[model samples]
Target: MHRVVVTGLGIKSPAGNSPAEAFATVLAGKSAAAHLPALLEAGVPVTFGCQVPDFDPDVYFPKHRRRHLDRPTQLGIAAATDALADAGTPDAGRPAGPGTAGSGTAGSGTAGSGTVRCGTYVGTGGANIGLTADFGALPHDKLPVATVPMIMPNTTAARISIRHGLQGPCLTFSCACASGSIAIGEAAMAIRYGRIDRALAGGVDSMLNPFAIASFARISALSRRNDAPQEASRPFDRDRDGFVMAEGAAFLVLEREDLALMRGARIYGEVTGFATGADASHIVQPLEDGSVAARTMLAALADARLRPEDIGHVNAHATATTYNDRAEARAISACFPAGSPPVTATKGVTGHLLGAGGAVEAVFALLCADAGLVPPTANFTGGPDADAIDVVHAAPREIERLPVVSNSFGFGGHDATLVLSPR
Candidate 1:
């Protein structure tokens, strides 16, 4: 088995575009949620959401070529492009094929390989459905000629693979919000098991559209603090309402540890362990007892070959919803029965990113480890379960060393986690 490490990271999120900018923004503890005029004009109960600032696809992809690609796909390409560049991926001039024994195929230098060994793995929820629904509302014959291709969930993965010439397995995981973390976890497994040398793995999602917001609002899943959008997403707070719908994308370049070291790549951190499970008891509600969530965390810890005490901190999935926060609090208590570690929830600031939430939070986790600081959870006031779980709020806490468990659970019982240790 091979060890996997993150050689590069890219993010296009409500917080910020570049990793440095995003991390800085998060550390400052500022809320990205704001009222969208369109939503307010439509009378959506919840008009506030976190949106990527100044998004212009023309800068990311050629306008002519991107006519058929959906917003999520475009965002994915932009993040992936930044990641590959961050890793300083060689564009050309490399040994021939993966068939050649030890010919630099572990994302070290394979841009010119005849049989590229790099793979593309990504995740998104309602990717195609979002675009299709939007176009479906248009008049007949007004849709583009490539409507079929645009509506395929796999379009993101396929286009990413084609654009970068990664010939390995192209996969798309659409398991709701857990989709992002699952993509990262499963891709690491592929590398560990030698299915491929390396992969571009992450997730992208967009629910900022008016229709999606209206549906979520109708279901009462969004925060209703239209007047004070910044103070709305208070994860773990006693007065916490509902999650804020947001959109963005994130990606990571996972490479074999040995290859990354040999090529002298700057390693952010090592992806030591990843595990996933399901609530199974409810569709949208996490098992109130948190048994499944606890098991998933323990499983990830076990996979990382670490005891419960090894986790220095936790990056909670904390959507600020009452049910999820309570369940996750119980689950964390179960994992660390002795005492809880410092926990921070970025959703308070970034809002609930849905499919992109997990990946973006994972990036934040690794960056937190690298920076030796844990950012505060925005608008946190210590909810009823506060005594049981020490929610980090108000300001950042310094913890220079140790592993962090980043959790991402989704509607319909999906739960996925990653254990990252600073390198």
Candidate 2:
């Protein structure tokens, strides 16, 4: 089987717009959660969320073209474009075929003649819910003709394919929070099987509108600590009320190891393992036993030919929910020996990005491997169960070269894990 490696990363997150910026923000233990003026003015029960500030769509898409895309699609396209550029892939408009000069190499190289088939795979939790609500509010006569295309869940992947000239498989996964991780895992598998030479895979979700916020509020899934937005998303704190809603997108450029090496690409890390499964216990709540979640982690380790001790850090799918934090803690404890790897839950700073959580957290994991530093989990106030695992807080922790695991569990019992190793 061929090896898969990450060549580029692009992120538009609450922390920052680029990978460097976002990772720096995480290292600084900054909290992006803030009060949403729109939600507050509208009298929504959940008024605080982590939103991508100062995002100018015009910078990514022209005026006429922007009208056809919803917020998620726009974010996805921008992230994908950035990933491709970072990978040193040629522009989509260029006419370069297979084996052409400057096509296979990393810096300023084309996608290696047309023979190097490229693909796009992205995931989202809610596909344009905000746009759907807007269409519903508009009069029938005023409804736009492009409503269906804009509201479709596959629009993000489709737009990414069009923008990158990806002629291979183009797919979208909607496995709730695990959507992004699953997409990235499958993309790596495609390269391993020689189905595609390269791929743009990640997740995006933008549903911060009033209707979407209200829907989550009705379900009691959002944090209501309006007076202290920054401290609202306390992943493992006993006082944790619920998760804070957030919106963002993250994309990674995955290329076959041999291809990347041949093109002299700057490899971030090797995607050595990926595994996904379901709990088969609950639709909304994870099984308290955490047995199924443990299986996912073990499977990923087995796939990577690694042992529990080989993992130096864990990027947890800690959504700051009461049950999720407890269940995930149990799962981690079950996966490794007592007091093994240091774990960090990034949602404490970025809030919960829902479907985009897995992808964005995956990026954080890779960055950790690259920098040899484990970022602290912000807003972590000690509680009774705070010592469930070796939670990294207060400051960043440095380590030698070692594998890292990133876990993502979503609604419908969807569970995914990916193991990354520094190049």
**Pick by lDDT: which candidate is best?**
2
Q: For each candidate, what is the lDDT?
A: 0.86, 0.86
The per-prediction tally of clashing pairs is: 0, 9
lDDT of 1 by residue, 243-318 (tens): 9888889999998887677668899998999999988888788899889999999999999999988888999999
Model 1 Cα displacement at 77 (Å)? 0.9
Weakest 10 consecutive residues, lDDT, candidate 1? 100-109
Instruction: Tell me the tens digit of each residue's lDDT in model 2 across 352-385.
Output: 9988999999899999988899989887876655
Which pairs clash (backbone N, Cα, C closer than 3 Å) in model 1? none
| Best candidate according to TM-score | 2
- Runs of candidate 2 exceeding 4 Å displacement: 92-114
lDDT of 1: 0.86
Whole-model lDDT for model 2 versus the true structure? Answer: 0.86
